[model samples]
Target: MSNKFFSVSVTNISVAILTTILISACAGNRIVNNDAPVEQLQDLNDYDSDGVIKAREKCDNTVLGASIDNYGCGNQITKMEPFKIKINFANDSFAIPDNAYDKIRVLADFLKENQEIKVVIEGHTSKVGKVNHNQTLSEQRAKAVVLVLIHDFKIPAERLDYIGYGFQRLEDERQTEEAHAANRRIMAELTHTEHLDEMEWTIYSVDQEL
Candidate 1:
């Protein structure tokens, strides 16, 4: 009878030990899963500042013969002439008029055709408003054009640059409203001129107002 009791006790002990071992293994696996390092999620399809998505680009979209920097952006290999393309804005506004569409289309086409030529589109305003206010408005106008190129025309962002000069860089400085309207404009400057070293324009002096 004592032997029988001893055997039963030993069998129960073995079963308890086995259950504990199984539970410990499951706990270990849970801990490992909880502590596993998570991989950072990179959006391959997202548009970069230059409006190019690396995932879908066939060409590396990098300047040829350029060296890559620490952040993987490339160095400039060639100096291009700044091509000037100007678009006048409506009175005190940057809204694109229907008449302006064709000209914008042409500019977009030109930029698309010449992939190597980067453009700096500058926005300027007349001297009617405060200088600081004009500067901000001018920048917004330039950015508006950029949006059109990037979103509507699918122009790559790398080919575009922008700045706002406000009333500081005007073609004319007549105090009349008509002159102010004429002064408000968006203009392009090519970063690298394949054929020329520089571009020339008749920039009016901002010091004197008619």
Candidate 2:
């Protein structure tokens, strides 16, 4: 054969060999038989005979499935619980009664023990006055409890929040003296914040491309 023809033949052979090798490599990486069982398929992108691709799931896999959220990741959900106290105030007064001090102290102790737990002092009032006046009174009642917890019991002010619902969230909505007394109250709601950092990580991981 001529030298030019021989060189061209060799070049064509090399190109064919390279193309075959590339095809083999790609085939080796994929699941060849679509009708194969799930156990026979390998890797995350395996497809079934119906052309449905399998999903790859990543989970926290903690004990009792505690750390898993709806997306199967370690997302810590902050839970809140009521403090075991029945804080009642006299009619038309925002003062924290001396009788309720002991219960407030119990709440303060809980805060002191669990520093990571913050609290919201919710104040409510009876439906006996104008909307604005009752709202102000409820706010004062919540603030009074907050001040007591911060100043008297030495709980950190940063860990405390207060809100006034006034007559909007009455315990008993009857037009009776007892219902009004029951409505004028303060409640402590404990919030968990220790897992917030882990929760942020979970959110970021979800937004990332696989």
Candidate 3:
């Protein structure tokens, strides 16, 4: 071959080799960067922007129009009113009456459902007795209720507290029997550490295969 023709052929071969090397280098960089292909990255269905995959959500009967959390469970604001149950005792007796069982059951159910709520049981007595005697009677009444809650109703002892108010804070000071009966009572006050409506998010894990 002539020198000029040979030179042209050599240059063409070099250009082809360089082009192949450049393409290979770009492919290698993509592999090292671990970039997923466009088809693999694209979601097949419309997903919620709230970070929850609908198919993987575990909660059912979610409230409509309410804001959902990361688990697709809607936020619910449970406002519980303070509950009170009065158990009237016969004069000088701390025994729980049969009628008080239903009220105690209601209180137990409430405590069971709301585990975070703590209750204080206050016992009060009429002013017909001496200060020390009344105080002891009041304490016994409060403790009796606590025992029933813990043993019969399976309420946690840690969530309950009792105090005896005795005749110091009488609900009624009248000399009538009805007023005195009202004063001999047990009061349960439920309190929470935080407001029930405070915003909290539910966290859940999704199955990657789904």
Comparison by TM-score, 2 against 3, better one: 2
* Cand. 3 TM to true fold: 0.55
Q: lDDT tens string, model 2, 1-210? A: 899999999999999999999999998895667785567453454232222234543443333313344444455668879874577788899988899989999899888888889999988999998999999999999999999988899998999999998899988979999999889988888999554324233555666746
CA RMSD per model (angstroms): 19.2, 13.9, 11.1
Each model's lDDT: 0.70, 0.78, 0.79
Top TM-score hit: 2
- Model 3, position 107, has a per-residue lDDT of 92
Worst-scoring 10-residue span by lDDT in model 1: 196-205
* lDDT of each residue in 107-174, candidate 3, tens digit only: 99988988988888888899897999999999999888998999999999999989998998898989
TM-score of each: 0.52, 0.59, 0.55
lDDT for predicted candidate 3 compared with the true structure: 0.79
**Model 3 misplaced stretches (Cα beyond 4 Å):** 1-82, 196-210
lDDT of 1 by residue, 1-210 (tens): 699999999999999999999999988884434676777575465233333456444335444333334333544445745445456676567777667767778889997887877778888888886878888889988888887888888899877878999888767767877777678777887765343212112243233333
**Structure candidate 1, residue pairs in collision:** 50-157, 80-192, 80-193, 81-192, 81-193, 83-190
